[model samples]
Target: MSLPVNIDEYSRLVVLDDNELQAQNVAVSVRERLQRLRGIYAYWLQFPSKFDKEIVDYDMKKFKVGRAQAYDDLHLTQILMGNLQQASKEFMRWKINRDLEEDLRLARQRGDLRAAASIEKNRIMNNRTDKDDEPELEFDKIVPQQFEMTDDPTVIGIQKVPGLRDRIRKLEKKYGDTKIEDADYEEIKEEHDGNGTGS
Candidate 1:
């Protein structure tokens, strides 16, 4: 990169030459490749189980990319998709986008203005599809009918209030004890049940 630099008859060495420019171009190229791969990975995500040839073809055509690049992206996606055991709405969204993009790409490539416009319109309509189609979440649809929430201590206190005080009073009056707490074991009386559970 160190070539002759002449500035008004003054020549010196410079580290930045065509090589540096080429390096910058290389950086841009790598960045674009990564973005394309990421976009590809976002679609048809279920991997082997949900691998659709039409979907893959659509994505590749939409991306205006060769199958080699799509294959690379799919390989990487398969590795990353290992953890996704089930299909989700997110996947469906990506799948839809990929399909639309593919169709739009094909339309544009074929110079079919009408088809491209229609696809774009469909994409716009799809943006709000789930909004009217169904609830945002199953949990959001839970409309309780006279629902009541109580803490554990409050519930136990409420349930025991009616009988607890009366029982304590009866025990206190009967045994005449100050504590009125439960005994560990009842004395083995002569006419007790054989099970020993005091039943």
Candidate 2:
């Protein structure tokens, strides 16, 4: 079966079997054009306040291209620079982090332990990205921890805990200096518990 194809589109393909030198010349011209375009792009990116006309003038003088070609190069450069990632803050941050990691790798390879440690420390200390060591926040655990909140003051100003409590004793030893009689502490504890009133 004959395939259906657009003859007009196929006619655009040229066979360059005889004109080899002309094909080579076209290839070289394209290469030079793209190189010039890339140079214009780099010049335009050097500063945010750089004017488009300045870039076009630089390209025209630098590459000896006409005003129209220089402006075309500037237009292409603007389109290339307009990419989402290239202009985003996150991309800049990621690029810096990647560069630091590469430096760290090279330092370690050369056995420069001090430089490697410094680079690694910089990567961690900078508040740029989410660190792996950061704990995943748990909503359920956000409830304030239940401690034995007491006001008797006996736990602190007592002689001995009899080890009745562990955490309370720790707090008392750390914060309290005065000590009370053990018998009186026990009586106060009973009164606070409402056991002494016998209501």
Candidate 3:
């Protein structure tokens, strides 16, 4: 589906405004346009040449760009996508910070000293100047609301730590006898190590 504005008009989004409200407005618009373009990109990937005119027309009518500008300029499209990705990351970061602040506020209000201390420490460490500006939270536990058993053989095999430990013991015995190939033994050992089954 095409956007209301031509894709070329959205070139302004490449240089977002300094004003928070203006930037948010542009980001919302750009997100919609990007979603539309993503659908077209997916379709083009599947059916290569079929939607060329449709995509071009959508870009021209909505973005106010010429045919050549709309159809051939992949670099511009990629840049817009990059901007969207950055905006999304920033938004998620902001949301996480906001949530943690809210949680800390609640903890303080409830006078939960232990929870407040841990959450405050996490917030401080997360916003520490020496480290990268990333959001981190310390949780006592993660209780999954739902769990499902996978039918996939690979997943089933990976989940079987006991079976893997037994195999590792067999591999170790073979390795001692010099009966197993070094490559095969190393590969199994790597898997065993990943499973945290042995030293």
Best by TM-score: 2
Q: What's the lDDT of the predicted structure labeled candidate 2?
A: 0.60
Which ten-residue region of model 2 has the weakest summed lDDT?
A: 9-18
Candidate 1 TM-score to native: 0.25
Question: Which ranges in model 1 have alpha carbons more than 4 Å from their true place?
Answer: 1-26, 45-49, 80-199
Better candidate by lDDT, 1 or 2: 2
lDDT of 2 by residue, 140-163 (tens): 222333469875567788565465
lDDT of 3: 0.56
Candidate 3 per-residue C-alpha lDDT over 1-199 given as tens digits, one digit per residue, 9 for 90 to 100: 1223454665654444436425566566456445445544554455544444666676677667555545543324544443333455567667777888999999999999999898877776655644775553212132324557864456555544457767878898977575655463343533356667865
Model 3, TM vs. native: 0.27
Q: What TM-scores do the predictions have?
A: 0.25, 0.29, 0.27
lDDT of 1 by residue, 1-199 (tens): 1122223221111123446535655355444544554555555453534544454575578777655445544444444443242355558767888999999999999999999999988887766663565532222233434547854356555543557767978988988856867769867766558787555
Q: How do these models rank on lDDT, best leading?
A: 2, 3, 1
**Between candidates 1 and 3, which one is better according to lDDT?**
3
Number of the top candidate by lDDT? 2
lDDT score for residue 172 of model 3: 88
Between prediction 2 and prediction 3, the one with superior lDDT is: 2
